[model samples]
Target: MSLRTVARDDLKNAARSYVVLGVVGVFAALVALVFVSERNIYPDPYRTLFDVSFMTFLVFPLFVAPLSYLAVAGDRESGVVKYVLGLPNSRLSYVLGKFASRASVTLGAVVVALLVGFVVALATFENAPNLGRFATFAGVSALYGVSLTGLFVGVSAATRRRSRAMLGVFGAYFLLVPFWFGFLPIVNIGTVLDAVATTFGTTVTESTRSFVNALSPATAYLYATEPVYSGVTDQYPQLAGTFGGESSRIEAQLWFNVLTMAAWGALGLLAGYASFRRSELG
Candidate 1:
């Protein structure tokens, strides 16, 4: 079979599985939340929605962990991948097509959720947040989600064993993520000093200041709450620090966070694809 033909057929098989259904579930939940939250006192609905989007960080992992496993293990179990590999298609095309189809579905979930969230925020809050910044955040998060999810998919693909794929993804989520965003950055004594200064009236330590600028992605994510822009009707946090904080009134600019997200996402994709490339199909 030709590569294109094989890819088209594989994607069709995937469509019948629970992957698409999971994305639809997440999208629907976000939309439903917007409807119920109409009575909220948010000053910027986008910030509220943005805050809510963090759930994607949690949801995406679960969705991809299992689906990625099935992508390859199922084929292997049925002896179809080997059958297909005998065709004239290159291994690279097969991997790419598999990754693309799976990632596209997950990305679809994120885009649909964020779009619906933005619309509800506009309608409910009565003011639009920084669309550019919001878009930047959305795009970065989507990429990261795909990369993260695709990496897990690749793991399952490589293992050709369903149990191993699930375990791999879960282990990475709990263990690897914490190590990267948690322990690696927690050793910064400077951040503690800085947080102390910001919390209490003390001489602003440059060391602390240094730490603040060098915060980890996970740490930053923990504090990624929308700065409550007070007096802004229908906003989430209702403070002015929602953007990039009090750094010269550039509120709600998530450029740095988005950049970090992009970096992690790229790393995830590269690691997953590279690992998949090295595997010998059974």
Candidate 2:
């Protein structure tokens, strides 16, 4: 079959995954509940929704990691990959096809979940998030999911063994990504910056430090999708507490956040493509 044809079939198969369905269901339910709570418990709807957006940081990894892991590693373990290759498919095509299929499913789930959040928020507060904010949230959220899918699938493609792939991807998700966050706080970034300044005669501001700290995908996604709810006090007099509050905001621009996510995906794809090309079947 042609590459596109093969990719289409893969998409269909990926869509059938029960894991994907479960994640989507959970995401939708959580979003709905958050909105439902906004109507009752949370007096400040904007702040409440802002807090709710942080859940995306958790959901991005939760959804993409398993889907990408099973896409290649499971097939390899079951010997399905050998059959797939025998059908005149290249390893590169297989990797790309899997990326397309799995990433689409990841993105689709996020969109549906966000849609539920939007509808319920409108119904509850009689006010919806700004149109621009919602669009950016949906688009960036989808891209964030895709980037993660590429990263995990690439890791999975690097090994034919399911166990190894699982270990590596899990390490990346749990340990590696969070490492930057933990390491930065302990290691004295100021000292590191001083060394850079001494050597290169350049100064770094706190804003620059904040930007650098956002290098991790987790931080980057959080920064990019942060809801900016201006004039919430004027619109909903009850939600004035949400106005002028400063928490959970990050210091990177939208472009930098996008680039950070894209870089993770690109690096993963390159790593997976290179390694998978030389990988031996069991």
Candidate 3:
């Protein structure tokens, strides 16, 4: 079969899987809650929906890791991938096909959840939802989820053991990425040096903590969506203005967030393909 056909078949198979269905349900429920609760706080449905959805996706990896960690690792462990490879498919085609299928599934789930949010907003609030803004949010949120899925799938493909692959992806999401954010404060040697310089009546330098925050995909997603979520009400004052256009040191440029997420997905797929190409199944 052609690679496109292979990809289509993979998509169908994933759509039927219980795990995929379960993830979709969880996302829909979360989005629904966000919509139902925020209606009372924000004056407009669009703003309420946008705020909750965008904030929920800030840690998008947490939602994506479980579904993607077993994308290839489970098949590889069960020896099913070997037979599939024997069916006139190159390793690269297989890898690409799986990536396409998983990304599609991730995107579909996000759209459904967004739709649930939209419905909830319509039912609860008197103000009309902004279809245009909601559409934009859905597209960006799906892109973020797919990017995270690719990263986890790559980690899964690289590992021989299914348990290791699963644990590794979870670790990368819960530990490594968070560490990237947390370690910045702990190791702000530059800031410390600047303080020392100030004590000496010398020029003080600024630290690159913002650049470090932008390095995390979660932070990048949050920064990119900040432009669209206006009218954050007083209910959650702390979360208000989160989506404002004001660029701080930690906020990545809008273009940078898009590029960083795309780069992350591409790099992860490439790494997985390379590893799959070289490794022996037996």
Candidate 4:
């Protein structure tokens, strides 16, 4: 029917996800900070930043991803799909409402956590990251969150079986997201090299530089992680010895991740909306 009516319902459902994710994120962050501080092994700002951002971006998203599965399945389970489908609005509108409402909530929480994490990190760390780098890092993280949430929503919309949908969501996370996070670091050597090349008086090769620019997500993590933690790798060689420059230039790779994540997220939203519209809700 009307957007107002749809929004009201969407808001109610989204609250559940926010409450659950918020509690888990806060508790986990506190525990992690305490545990790391106890070790007293030379404070690593990059690690700390990773701990904080991972909790906010990766960990929390893991839990909230399940919400996408439940949204449509829950409606179907309750037998309300028939009535809702019969409303004056097109299914597209209804689906978009769900996506807009829930995604907004998830996106907001992530943005807040990252900002707060940066502030806390800066105050705590002796070496504060530059503001420009920090902004780029946050943008990349947001795109990642969007991609994570959007895909799950799409999968959920496409399935009638709740368990199947969640499994699909989580399965993709374990298999693909990690590969992107861990391995992509290798290719993202540009920024890391750029910083280090100055010392060597020899710049990384252009092809190798492009690989780093196209693949690495490390810089994204580095920028956000710097104030929060230490040991965040800013760069790496694209390959073992194929003329890929030193890792220092890899920090530049974060922008590639930012754009890629945004592209996936946009696709996910489109898929979710389309699937939701086609869904009979029967």
Off by over 4 Å in 3: 183-207, 230-251
Candidate 2: stretches off by over 4 Å:
41-46, 183-208, 226-251
Residue 262 local lDDT, model 4: 58
CA error at residue 96 for candidate 1, angstroms: 1.0
Candidate 3 global lDDT: 0.73
lDDT (tens digit, per residue) of candidate 1 on 1-282: 554665577668767867577655666576548544752655555556555545555455566566565666667667877877787776666766676677767676677766776666666665565676556556655655665655666666666667776777787676434443344476434545656776887766554453344344333442343332223424333334334344432112455555554555455555656766677666
The sequence of per-residue lDDT tens digits that candidate 3 reaches over residues 1-26 is 55686679878888888888888888
- Relative to the unseen true structure, what is the C-alpha lDDT of residue 224 in candidate 1, on a scale of 0 to 100? 40
Q: For model 4, how does the per-residue alpha-carbon lDDT over 1-282 read when each residue is reduced to its tens digit?
A: 865677578777667665646744664455346334623432434444444454544465565575555666566667776688787976666666666666666656556655655565566665563565456445655556656666666766666777777787776665444543444554423445766887889888876665544442322442323332112343322111222334455443444455655555567667766776766665
Whole-model lDDT per candidate: 0.58, 0.74, 0.73, 0.55
- Backbone clashes in model 2, listed as residue pairs: none
lDDT over C-alpha atoms for residue 179 of model 3: 60
Candidate 1, poorest ten consecutive residues by summed lDDT: 227-236
User: What is candidate 2's lDDT per residue for 150-198, written digit by digit as tens?
Assistant: 8999998887778898888887886435455554554444566667887
- lDDT for model 1 comes to 0.58
User: Can you give the lDDT of residue 246 in candidate 2?
Assistant: 44
How many clashing residue pairs appear in each of the predictions shown?
A: 20, 0, 2, 28
TM-score of 2: 0.80
